[model samples]
Target: MAETKKYVRIKKASVDGVWYADKIGNVYEVDRENCVSILTKRGIRGLSSVLREDAELIVTEKRPAKVGERVLITVAAPIGKQAYETGDVFVAESLYDPFAKDIRVLGIPDFIDYNEYEVIVDNELKNGEADGMESTYVRKQSEGLDRVAKSLGYVELAKSSLKQNGFIGEVHTFDLLTECAERLREQAQTHKEKIERGYPEFSPVHKSAQARRDEIVEQAKADVERLRENNIRLRTFNISLEVNRKDRSVEAIAKRPKSNRAFYGIAKAAPSDCFNVHIGKAIALRRALGLGVPDEYLNAPQPAEVRVGDVVYGKYSEAYYQLWCEDEIGDVSYEVKIKEIVDGKYRYVGGGYDFIDDADLTIIDDSREGVVGE
Candidate 1:
């Protein structure tokens, strides 16, 4: 009996202002046969009038190539006495890897590198075939076992090499190696037995295997979460590289435009001899985004003594946000001179300069060469 497949082409835009989700005249595959409306993967749904019956059924499936499928080699690889050239088509007999990138095919003495191959056709399901989904699950289980067996093979190879090159270590070291070798052999035998006894259950019943599967899933989720965070950071810190060149000094400015017709401006300056435009831009951008600057950016050793014309920063005031005391604000810069010295404290000649301790000031730029500190 011919299969009855349903296809749809959207004829009108959605009323919910989600036009981008589905265009006015794009075809899509639907699971239902006779429905008045359909919800697509893009989240578009409406009345029957919004859809037009499409004659061509689109079967879009994204999955790794499986065994028993026809594939065309895109890359030429030499194996044994003969070479498999590009454009050679073959039916894969067995998958040697989880991704189906390495396979064993008929008429090939060695495993073929199937990574550089295009799928000619997928294996068709027969009338009395075992459930396709169930077969796929079993195949995946077998592939995982194959991987474990391959790893054990490598361990056995290493053990053989270690025994061949007689150990120069003490007696206990040799004993340890022997114990590891025995364990590896036992593991290999166990994996071989499991492969012979085909996987019948939907999921692994053993606690150790289930825990390992959960660990893999959790690790994958962590990797995806980290990538998402990194993408956000990249978008937030989008910066352009430019340098303002002034005689003996270079300045890097970072600008971030806000929706309120204003922008965040941050600038950093360095002597032309020691300036790296890229690092300067990164530092300025981080500061503009209120992020922590790397320690390597502040590489120069700060001077022990404060001199005249030296630019300095002071912990001027404490900030309070929402009635709660926040961090200390240190953006205010000051340049002062010693006007008088009393009670082992120095008073400077500047705006509101008073008897301030030396520890309260941090010298940031010491450029003036001949000026003396009094």
Candidate 2:
């Protein structure tokens, strides 16, 4: 069956009017003069600037928003207005004014165009047009009117203060300043807590010091184990040449190959072309030799009897070996041992020697059916 994708429903606000929301609910107001289209048609840049300012207002000052959190905007006046006398919730309704036509509701991703709004407001104030909305009256019920008045008065006072202090007469500036102040306070509190806890300097390195030490130790152990497992042996022989000075005669002596000579155990060596040896092969050899064997191998039971021609199998590497059985048979099963061990590979070698099938090989200390012994 195919999987289905999930979707979430998000509320949209009109771009035509001032969006306002109270504890009761949200409301939209249509002011043709301040509609999104007018701002866009006159210059999309201007509209973008307004949106940026509004977003900063919501984030830095009015109500700080979490990242990706939904922000609701309404066209009605701010909360705590006189029009809310009956404590009636503000609801969006059609405007009776003809000038309010052609307003639209738009849904946009949060934080989009925030910087643009700042720029537009900044440019407008620089051109001495920041007071354009001073005479704009938003129609509402008595309580709503009172709330709007209060909100507007607050906005005016804020603007006047900025102007007197030589700050830009822009809504975004006021909102951003408020936001900066709040952020500064939060940071100050956080710093104080860290200092009280005896942490004069707070950094990622200090926080993860212990964890980093543990990680390094673990890595070192892994590297050592890897090196030990990869170790192999190399075989070297000494050739002797005899010379008789008086007779001017020379003789060369060659050494016979012994059973032990066949086994070249070294820390590292390339596999011979006659036999393929891989990392798995090296591991299996170590296990068969029982040299430096791990505890897991030490706990395992030893074979009842390992004949010359018997086949030795490694469970982990899936490698198989057949030993030459006798001396008369130059390549007797017990004498000639063929070992196959390689990383990421399995090998099979059997010639009348006791051997287990690949499929039956397992780590558990249990025997499978049809084996020579239980």
lDDT of 2 by residue, 203-311 (tens): 1111122232233323333533444444322223222333332232223332223433322222221121011112223333343334442321211122232222223
The numbered model that scores best in TM-score is 1
lDDT of each: 0.44, 0.27
lDDT of 1 by residue, 1-374 (tens): 32333334443442334343355445444554311123343335542222111121233222334654555564557575765765455555566755456776545667776455555532221111133434544464466456445544654565567678885355664564455445445655664565566545553232222233233323333443443356357654333334453332323333333433322334455442233233444455455445654333333222445444444445443432223444455354454544445565555657444344633765544443244531
Best candidate per lDDT, number?
A: 1
Q: After superposition, how far is residue 163 of candidate 1 from its true place, in Å?
A: 3.3
Q: In model 1, what is the error at residue 366, expressed in angstroms? A: 80
Q: What is the clash count of model 1?
A: 0
TM-score of each: 0.19, 0.17
TM-score of 1: 0.19
Candidate 1 has an lDDT of 0.44
